[model samples]
Target: MDTFTELFGTSPLIWAILGAEAAFWILLFGGLAVRYLLRNRRLSTIMLIGVPVVDLLLLTFTAVDLAGGVEPNFSHLIATIYLGFTIAFGHSLITKTDAWFAHRFADGPAPAKKPKSGPAYVRAAWLEWRRVALAVGIAVVGLLAMQVMVGWAVPSSFAEANEDVIWSMALRLLLIAGIWLVAGPVYATVFKSTPATDTTQRVSPASDTLSNHR
Candidate 1:
């Protein structure tokens, strides 16, 4: 234990953050593989939840270290909450990116496409914008919750390290929202031109009757 502590002694908190980062990717890919490949949603949920549990371990350690009068790095707190956001919101980002790629290049049906022009184009743009808005809203809520947890855990140390943490987080959130908002319009443009194979036009009864008469 002495050697172990010595190795991480200089930056125990950074080590914790590194551990959480590793946990995040492992949980994401592993959970996705189990969820889709094995088709075991229950197990997948467990794996996904386990991602944040890694941070919980770090939190436990940090709290203990603090109690022992050891100074902890503030980045450890940020990394904890950062991983929480990844656990909470990463799936949505992944799903959306997958969908966008599929629509762009896949041979199957184009799900997001609409009529090329006129009111249909406008409507599709509006709907796409709304979807982006919803994602932004979910992300904002996740960040707020994360901030609250950080606020509770390392109120003094975080402030000492960076008094503008709240503003930093806010600006980060805004940058995320901005990216999505810009992507919304690009997605809107892509959806406006429906693929020929994707179109589903119903024949009118009158046309059928006329054709039969002929």
Candidate 2:
């Protein structure tokens, strides 16, 4: 506890962001548990609703912290990136997690696994890249908004202090976006698996000979 405080004491926004992320997971699993294990949909809904509430709290904390002249740092950048991804992907994440929980606790059908290769795999890769693009767009918007807020709220010198960190954050985000695009959709497209080739690889010589004879 002492170590944690010492590391984060100067950055309340960082602490708040961490707390928000922890709370998101807790509410997600807790809501699913209540829904499947306890069979209480109403209570579970309330808990799940709190997931977005956590994001709102974190956003408010960030805005207030910045407005209060807390010079922007890496933590502030993280807070915005976290918010963007959560806003972009939170529902799908919750739905996927809920399916798993339901399968485990409520005898629901198992969730379908993503295809590892072939056309389906390529499609999935493209879909994931789209999500990444959306997330990056949202994060960039958030960084801009915060930058504007800082410029408006504080003196020029104070706002200028944040420019380097803000630019760093933007570059980092772009780097991640570029890497994901190339590794996911671009790679998948370049090395896509064909159904015939996949079937041929799976068929043994004996099976192929027997089928040919038939």
Candidate 3:
């Protein structure tokens, strides 16, 4: 296709991706603003629903296009990146936004919940890993799906002439495997090792008794 044709043809896809990206950031910040600034749980909860709706629409369009053999475009990659950021930084983003909003207008201090440990910590870590794994897994699946679709849809000579570097990696399977198995436990262990405060340190029983007496 000509440059103009390709660009014009992909415009709808681009807009869809942009809409999804907008939905994510808007719902994130908008929901926090409602919860902290407006102090409206009902409204905030309703706004929060938009996040998944956007993701659902994005995924539906992606699957439809791929299943129908549309060649992958840059917008698809942007959507993937958007989803990645949302999954990875979502909680932090919401918490920080809430804290900032509350600091300014909620007339109360931000809630500072301590990190969990033992079973709760393990469960939270597992859930986080699953979220990250799903994001990474989606990228991998999308890559593979594109490869299959392109092979099916495009002429072999045409695809060979315009092969993309993004799909050229042979070690993607290894990368996906590492993301699934290695990334989670390593991150959890490192996170646990780092304390939130440097002023606190463990002391022996004698030192504790002396300090208490003093």
Weakest lDDT window of 10 consecutive positions for candidate 2: 152-161
Give the candidates in order of TM-score, highest first. Answer: 2, 3, 1
Task: Give the alpha carbon lDDT tens digit for every residue of 1-214 in model 1.
Answer: 7875554456567677777778777886777677666768899789877866775776676556555654434453454455545545556655654455445544434556446665566566666566555645544554455445445433355445345554455456567767766666566566544533546787899999999999
TM-score of each: 0.42, 0.83, 0.56
Ranking by lDDT: 2, 3, 1
For candidate 2, report its TM-score: 0.83
Residue 201 of candidate 2: its Cα lDDT? 48
Estimate, for each residue in 57-76, the C-alpha lDDT of model 2 and write its tens digit.
Answer: 99899888888888877788
What's the lDDT for all of these models?
0.59, 0.85, 0.65
Report backbone clashes per prediction.
Answer: 0, 0, 0
Q: lDDT, candidate 2, residue 80?
A: 91
TM-score of 3: 0.56
Q: How close is candidate 1 to the true structure, as a TM-score?
A: 0.42
Clashes of 3: 0
